[model samples]
Target: MKQWNIGVYFSLRFQEIAGALDSALAVPILVPVQSSHSDENSQDLTLKQSVTLLESLRSCWSEDVLLISCADKFLRLSLQLLSRYSNWLSSGLADWKKGSVSSNPGCEWAISALPDDFIIHDINWLAKRICGDYLEGILQLLSTCSTEVLDLVKKSILHGGKSLSDLLPSVINTIIEALVDKSVEDLRQLKGITATYRMTNKPLPVRHSPYVAGILRPLKIAGCSRWRTSNNIFDRRC
Candidate 1:
């Protein structure tokens, strides 16, 4: 009975820890992502801080405490926070591509902080940065966990509830939704090509569509330096 009460006490303390996570998260998350990846500040300090906090806590907490209290709550919070930021970035990029980025409220901050090196990037640069090291740290941290810890975390989850196992995939889906959409949108040029050919009564060439190259350009430029081999979708090639 005493041991059970002690476990409960730790669990409740963990609840407090989880509760405070949002406020700690707000400092980095609520800021504009463009500023986070600006010329003067190439490093996304916001993202770095968030990941560091999670890693710090994971290291600081005992495995037994984590198993008892189900630290996967932190994973969920991370997903929410990253999704919000990623979605904001995605929307902003879409706006920029459409030739209408809204005025940045952080202009003053940028001027004051950057003084001389304040440079806002185009949609292409921003997307490349994200696909580069900005999100690479996040993916590596989220995906590279011990199998034993993962199984324990999974078992600790409530029945029929999401476990830590889902965090990586959920994050990949949410964060990459922007790139995916852009790639799909590139396909619209094909309609223009078909229209042009139909007007001339020529059969489409057997050669690969240049639109295929267009679709792949951003991804190829993004260069999968830190975005490869993290996905665990094992399948038979045979």
Candidate 2:
């Protein structure tokens, strides 16, 4: 028997994360839907727009965010369900994989926040299998947009169990390679710096924590106004 070891991490502030996301995404979604209600033909057109916007917003979120640490109960539960879902997905016999847990409230927040979109009534009646299908479809749509998105799909698969940093370099490299047209030598240098810093055995620098905080800020947002004019990664929208 092949044992697929999934190292699950649980983290606190899960609701806080969800709350921040809902706040950021909900309003931009509502406008198109509200405009659609006035006329029949225009309603249909606006409704489609609303659906796309909502779907995109929902799809933008990485499920991996919820799985950040080993202490999160919800994350553990989600993974257990996902493991079953993945197995079912791999099985050709099953038309769909069923998740024991419902992530529908997240989906509903997405849907109600954009009501003009066609409301599939009785959504509650759909089997867990169908919800899995919905998530699968949403992820599939996101995968086509950029190398960054494709790397996310790859991580979701390979990340059945792994440290987050273990995946960061590959993803960053993919984004840079696909969007920036960087050469292999440039990439190797970047990866080398990341690995040396991350894997070093030293006690860490006096500025280590802040240095990490600094690294997280997108280069353009880091107040190098001079460089922003020439290499505006912020505008790239990756």
Candidate 3:
């Protein structure tokens, strides 16, 4: 029989959510937080509030109930938006797996470092830079990069594969510039239709669904035959 550890799994989910939420809050508020005269005090207050909320949330739900409910919600969402949400889900799952696989103290350190405002600021900065010819370059990079290179970038950014402490300052600045450029109006208008058309033509692959990828591939492998490997689902196995 398959074994389950409800408490351990719930602790993991809470940690994952906490990290993501912290990241989401970090970005937009970073400049404001930094510029504040009482930056340290403000940061401490915000963190305390967040921790209190999370503690309250955990107290309200039993581990099994919370886990099952979240699973059901995700499954329902997946069924509704399989084509679009599949890639997102896979990426998130991959991040969680990466988080779990690293050394315990290292993992905790990574999670602790991923404060909410910081990630939000980074994404916001990225959005601003993704414009004009610069955006075209990024999309071109994204489109033309080898699968291995793309995988590496994904791991480096999303999976904590390297020392982001030293790397983040430069990468965040550059990515923000690239992303913001994309958000500009005239340039956006120029590319919007083409982008939509291209996206329609070459959709993002769902890493959690190999069958989906195989179906989308233009040609089949000759020797692979009718035999299909059932390795796409990115659930607990990952």
The numbered model that scores best in lDDT is: 1
- lDDT (Cα, tens digit) per residue for candidate 3, span 1-238: 1387655765576555445434433332222122232323223222222222223223223343344324433222212222221222233323333544232221232223222233333333332322222234323435555777555534433322122123345434433443343234333344454576576876664454333344323223311311221121111123
Count of clashing residue pairs in every prediction: 0, 7, 31
**lDDT tens digits, residue span 114-179, model 2:** 121122211111222224454464456454457775565545533432322233343334334323
| Candidate 2 residue pairs that clash | 9-69, 9-70, 10-69, 10-70, 10-71, 10-72, 11-72
Error of 1 at 141 (Å): 25
**Whole-model lDDT values for every prediction:** 0.40, 0.34, 0.34
Instruction: Please state the error at residue 16 of candidate 3 in Å.
Output: 8.0
RMSD of 3: 24.8
Model 3: lDDT equals 0.34
Candidate 1 clashing pairs, residues 3+ apart or interchain = none
Per-residue lDDT over 56-151 for candidate 1, one digit per residue giving the tens place of the 0 to 100 score? 343324344443233455445434433443343344334434444445321222212211101111222333443444334333443556777655
Model 3: weakest 10-residue lDDT segment is 227-236
TM per model? Answer: 0.34, 0.20, 0.17
Give the winner by lDDT: 1 or 3: 1
Best by TM-score: 1
